[model samples]
Target: MAGDKAVSTVSKPVMRGLLNSSIKRNLTVALTLAAISGVAFKQLVGNERKRKYAEFYRNYDAEKEFEEMRKKGLFQSC
Candidate 1:
């Protein structure tokens, strides 16, 4: 009976240690994947914004718009 009790007690700690190590490894992998995905998402968003900006200005006429704004009295000239 005492021998069985000792074995049970030792096994509990050993099992706990194994579980803790496994959990730590899994947590590390999860965090690493999350970080990589976050960076990838950021890059994708940045590239998309850049594409949209270029598309918007692809045929834009800045001087013509400025003249229109002046005609509309939206700009004051000194």
Candidate 2:
């Protein structure tokens, strides 16, 4: 048994290279998806803001709103 020896099929350097490649691929995918999601979310938020503005102005009169605020004593007496 003195002449018998064991050897690994894969070495440390090869394993490290494979691991690095995998990490790089996953990182690239994650970053790409994150960026796309962020852009999509911003678009959704912008559309929602426009909708809300339209809703607010549907029955809005600036003069009436100001008059109501004045009635509530919201303005300073300057």
Q: Which stretches of candidate 1 lie over 4 Å from their true place?
A: 1-10, 14-27
Compared with the true structure, what per-residue lDDT tens digits does model 2 show for residues 21-74? 999999999999999999998789978898899999997899998899999999
After the best TM-score superposition of candidate 2, give how far the Cα of residue 59 lies from its true spot, in angstroms.
4.9
Question: CA lDDT, every prediction?
Answer: 0.86, 0.86
Q: Write the per-residue lDDT of candidate 1 for residues 1-78, one digit (tens) a residue.
A: 768866644344566479889999999999999999999987999789998999989989999898888889986771
Our tally of clashes for model 2 stands at: 0
CA lDDT, candidate 1, residue 2: 69
